[model samples]
Target chain A: MNREIQLIKRPEAAPSHEHLKVVETEQPEPRQGEALVKLLYVSVDPYMRGRMSDAESYIAPFQLNEPMEGGVVAEVVQSKDDSLNQGDIVTAMLPWREYALVKADSVRKVDPSLGPVTTSLGILGMPGLTAYFGLMDIGQPQKGETLVVSGAAGAVGSTVVQIGKIVGCHVVGIAGSDEKTSYLMNELGVDEVINYKKENMADALANACPDGVDVYFDNVGGDISDRVYPLLNKYARIAQCGAIASYNVPNDQGPRMQMHLIKSSALIKGFTVGDYQTRFNEGFNYLSKWLKEGKLTYEETVQEGFETIPDAFFGLFEGKNIGKQLVKVSEPSSN
Target chain B: MNREIQLIKRPEAAPSHEHLKVVETEQPEPRQGEALVKLLYVSVDPYMRGRMSDAESYIAPFQLNEPMEGGVVAEVVQSKDDSLNQGDIVTAMLPWREYALVKADSVRKVDPSLGPVTTSLGILGMPGLTAYFGLMDIGQPQKGETLVVSGAAGAVGSTVVQIGKIVGCHVVGIAGSDEKTSYLMNELGVDEVINYKKENMADALANACPDGVDVYFDNVGGDISDRVYPLLNKYARIAQCGAIASYNVPNDQGPRMQMHLIKSSALIKGFTVGDYQTRFNEGFNYLSKWLKEGKLTYEETVQEGFETIPDAFFGLFEGKNIGKQLVKVSEPSSN
Candidate 1:
């Protein structure tokens, strides 16, 4: 027997348990060119919220009454393809079933020698790649320039702020809680940290960035972004990675930014990790090298059990996770 | 005796006669390394509106009670330097006086052979360069891609739309009136025209761009731009050249665009012509060659008299100009 999480209904605003349902299902069997993967670690991210709504987006909307799918670390219990073997620890975009059948080609074996297999779903995977490209490519942080990261305590943003530091930029991180700010300051060696919940963003940003912001890695776009826009230096670059703030708020309206962009001659580029698919290996190489040299680090907030997957995902919107939020579904078993 | 227009007061809303005043002044003699020039054609543009308010911007704000200055075609009345001679038709950023002394190097000689001397203020000048770089560098319109231009009949936008045609794009022009639409469609050879004042923008844009918008050259940034955001194709590019719609309206609020940008993975770049100062000759060669070959044409709304400059400048916000709006100050004297 196996259990699966399905989208019972599409969310109009913020996602909740009402939109999803946990159901029992028969165990999936591997067919030719496929492998039976038992879920080990389930990754939950803010971007997943966009897939719940049936809007014309970069990716397709999650189908109602079907198991929701996302990045996961799993173990192969049965194999029907030469590429994958039983007991292999792999990672792939898999459906939310406790045990599911996937094409062998879809799942890549995690090299545990580098770190934990869970890193494949995190620092060595989507979030890390997102941070790498969005910062280096779009943000283009130059040495001694001011770099600001919103949602700085989260998965992608935490990685972005660290990269900003590596580039010798005066890095400022904006997070929701004092604990997150402390982690960004003490653990990550960020130049400045602003607890958005405690301080006036405009004043804090002004005090933090004495020289106006040169590079901005925006993850939470709403009032947080609105404050940053006015402080942009001439020829500034903004990597508009994620707008998790507006995902649950429909028809989110704010002060127009066209004037601000023109005043500073700034550029804003919105992108997803998928946009850089061709350069994934290049990103992976740099991330792995940095990890090996101890120049990069990561954090994970793990929630236990398959039943907690929905709650773990819901926690993203509330900023409950300090870093990469994952659910430990089951331990990998030996062949 | 000479006359000059000065910004007496800054407008909180729309600019009008109350904010500007005509003042009498004494004509000055030219010093060594300077030339005395008589204004011929005063170029009135939308960007000038930005200088009226004391805001931190790319260019310095217009000082209160000082003569407002901008691009102008002038006739050198007397020369105290070798670089410029008497009666030479030149163009430069000069004060709004009937006659004024300027540094010889500050004014560039306008070759009369490159169409009319007024072309220095229109198709062969700042507007042309703005259209060139904003479209070519930022918009990156590929052949067969759908390109949309808002405020399509204005100086910068008119040139941009024509350039889109030259680049073999399916160009859609959005303007305020039927006459402007006709100028864009019948005269400029734009594939589609939308009179934003007359039609439902979302529906009109949907009907015009069936393949979706690949490039958006936005000049008017308000509700018109909000409509274009949803229809952007994958990896769309936007040249945010101007926001005339919001220049007069303080704290202009609109639907947040971060989600729209993320949905399509688009890029928006805001710029002024000065940002491409180094490539001026490159832009000029392309524009002049296109003009000589009849590949590009332009329109000018010329208002007579020195006093009419204020009204001409004011008219920009009303969408009164068909193309480049200029105030003819005086005819040039033969050497």
Candidate 2:
């Protein structure tokens, strides 16, 4: 029997452990063209909070009595298809469970030699792809242009700062703590880091970007985004990734953005990483090359044990993790 | 001597007659390379309200104790330049005064053979250029796409509906009254009309467009825009021309927009007609062809006399005009 966390009830405020129930479930067998993957790591993201509610959204809501779905890195224990085999590591959309039986085509075999299989859930995977495409396609940061990114020490934000630097842009990052700010500047090669908790955001941003912000990759919206609004240059592009500030708020009270948009003639666009799945291979190839060249680096805060999955997911809202927050359910098996 | 209304005090709310004071000034002779033009008509637009306040905006605020400036059709009373002769009809940015001493190069000779010089301020001038470039460049409406335009009987909105019809798109106009709605369907060839005052906006929009809206040309951005927000298709574009609904409101009470942008992967862009000065001639030539072919029609609610300029400006906020609102300041003098 395996312990699985199921959504017992929809959440009104910040989703607590009470909203989820840990119950024992019988392990199932893999069907035809399916693989039984022993879950190793499950990712915690801000977008998952939107799915928890019964409100109308881009994606379907998480059902009341079902396990919540998210990105996970797993090891194949058994396979019914010829393409995948036992002991092959892969990434798939599995729930908060110790094991999952997913369709073979739905899972992609992860190349461990490229980097850690855990990085597949962070820098070399969805978060990495989001940063690459969002910045290049939406933000369109040109050479010598100032690129400002909020939530800059997290998985997606860190990747954006690195990619901006690689493209010859002046990258400025906004992080929560001094440690995260130090990590961003020292390891990520970010041009400047603003400790949003300690420093005055408007002053720091204005000082860091003397010319003007040309591309704003927004992850944590609210007052942080409000401060960055007026500093935007004409024809600036804004990539709206996430609104971590308003995720926990029950009512609809985000930032006042109409006046800002009209004032700057800026382009603010919201997009999901799944929308660019057709360009996944291209993103992976470029990201892999950068990782191999030591131009890209990723970090993860892994909470051990399958029972800790709920705590790991809850930790995201509290800003407990430095980079990508993941729950490691099982250990890798030696071939 | 000519009487001109000069800015007396910066307005806080709806501009009254007290904010402007008529002062009699000496009518000077035409200088070298300049022409003295007797004003005929003056354009009154929502954007002028922004200029009335002593606040920083895209365009410079109207200087206190100085004559206001806007698009005007006039005739040259005297000329010192070879390019312009006496009694030649011209169009220039020199309205709100009886007589204007303008540089010869700054004014364009209006051809009365095409249409009335007043049409230049409505269909063939700023409003026309605003609709042309905003629809083609920003909205990018394709055939069979459903376009929803607010303030349907107003200057820019009316032009947008006609242009959408020219591009073979299903155009839906939302206006304040039944008369304006009738004008849009009967004269402008809009496929559907929704009188926001009489009908429920959401239900009316759902009934008018079954497939959902692709392009939302927003001229009045309050409740009308909020109603169209949910019905937008994926990757829909919103040409945010003016916010006539919130123009009179204080700065602290703007419309909410952050959640709307995130839910629909919509693009809301703000633009000024002056930004497209380089492409002005191109837009003028195309709109002129459309006008000559009878594919487009325009209505002007002309308020007679220069003294009625304040009344005409205030009439815009009340939605009193049918199409473009113009104040006739003087009579046209034939050479």
Candidate 3:
């Protein structure tokens, strides 16, 4: 029996496990050019929260009574395609389920020797690509410039800090807690860390970055972003990666940043990894090399069961995730 | 006796004539490398409204009990400088006074034979440069792309529409009234016009731009900007030039647009002409050629008398100006 978490209804606030129900169904058959993937791990991100609500968003909302979908690292249980074979490790977008049958071409083979398959769902996957393109293309951080990132302890934000450091920028991170702040400053080599919870964010930011910020990589938008707005130098670049702060809120009380933007003569752009499909291979190769050299390190807050997916997702909203949040569904298969 | 309007106190709302007092000052002498200019036309823009408040902004706030200063087209009555001669037409940053003395280098000579001296303050001056750079550099309208401009009958907005048309884009305009709408569509050759006062902006935008908006030249940034946000196509660009709608309001409340931006993969950039000073000569030469060739037309709502400077400045907030608003302090010099 294959157990799948079906979305029973749309959510109003932080979605709970009650909003989802585990249902059992007969295993699906793989037709020609298709393969069956037994899920190992599933990635949970703040953007997924947007998909749960039935609203106009970047990606379509998860339909009611349908299994929620996202990036998954799986192993092929059965194959009917020429390219893929049974027992081949692969990555696909088949989420919140124990097993899924999808088009073989839709799945990419993952080399187990490269790193952990779960890393493909984190550092080598969508979040990594998001950080790569957003920083390089949108933020356009120059060497010796000050790069400030909000939500700096999370997956995308942490990645941005490391990348900014690698590119020779003076990186300042703003995270929710002191532990995350220390990790960013000590482990990630970020020049400074502002504990937004305990400190005056604006004053700390101004003090840390005496020369105004050159690149602002935003993940949690609100007062933190509002505080960063006025300190941006002329021609400063802002990459609007995510608004984790406002994602769960039902009303429109986000920060008013228009005046600050105008006064600074800055550029604020919204970007997604999907937009850089043509350059994905380049980014992946670069990040993979950086990972192997130990120049990059990623942290994961792994939840133990498929049942904990909703809880793990909600953890993101409460700033519970230390880094990348993932749900381990099954043990890895040794081929 | 020389009369000038002096800033009496910082204002909280629409600056009434009482905020300014017409006072007599001694006729000033021209220092070395200076020229005495009899003021002809003084320019009034929305940005000046921001200057009236003693708050942190892009430029310094107007000083209390000081003469109000802005772009003025004048005639040099005396010269103590090598660069300028007596009886030369020039444009300078001068007070709202009948006469003034300024360094010769502080003023640029305007050839009335090229176009009207008033044109120096209108199409061939700051407004022209604003439209040129804001549209071309930031908005980047492509041929056949739909360019929608708010405040389309006003100075900067009208120039944006005309320049959009020149760049081979289909231009749609939004104005405050039917007469302004007609002027944009009929006289300015804007492809379509919406009277924002009567029409449902979203419905009108949908009807006018069936293919979706490719570029938005936003001047009035409140409900009109909010209405245009949903109409933007993939990779749309917004040049946030002004927010006249919220300039006078004690508090501004608008819909949060961060999510909408991510959905469209759009860019919103706020800029000033000063930011593009490196390219000013390029923009000036291009606009000057266009103005002389009859490719561009600019209108002015001239409020006669120096005391009307306050009223002329306030007119921008009420959407009363047809084009660039100017204060006529004295008659034009024929010599």
The best candidate by TM-score is 1
lDDT of 2 at B264: 65
Residue B152: error of model 1 in Å? 0.7
Residue A199 alpha-carbon offset, candidate 1, angstroms: 0.5
Model 1 lDDT tens row, B1-335: 99999999999889999999999999898888988899999999899999999998999999999999999999988889888888888899999999999887688999988899988888999999999999999999899999999989999999999999999999999999999999999999999999998999889999999999999999989999999999999899999999988999989999999988888889999999999999999999999999999999999999999999999998999999999999999877873
Badly placed stretches (over 4 Å) of model 2 are B254-256
Model 3 agreement with the true structure over A98-142: per-residue lDDT tens digits: 988878678888987779888888888888889999999999899
Question: Ten consecutive residues with minimal summed lDDT in candidate 2 chain A?
Answer: A251-260
CA lDDT for candidate 2: 0.85
lDDT of 1 at B5: 95
Which segments of candidate 3 are over 4 A away from where they belong? none
Tens-place lDDT digits, model 2, residues A40-64? 8889888898889887767899988
Ranking the candidates on lDDT from highest down gives 1, 3, 2
Q: If ranked by DockQ, best first, what sequence of candidates would result?
A: 1, 3, 2
Model 2 Cα lDDT, one tens digit per residue, B221-303: 77788788878787889887887776666654433455556666778887788778899999999999999999999998988
* lDDT at B71, model 2: 90
lDDT score of model 1?
0.93
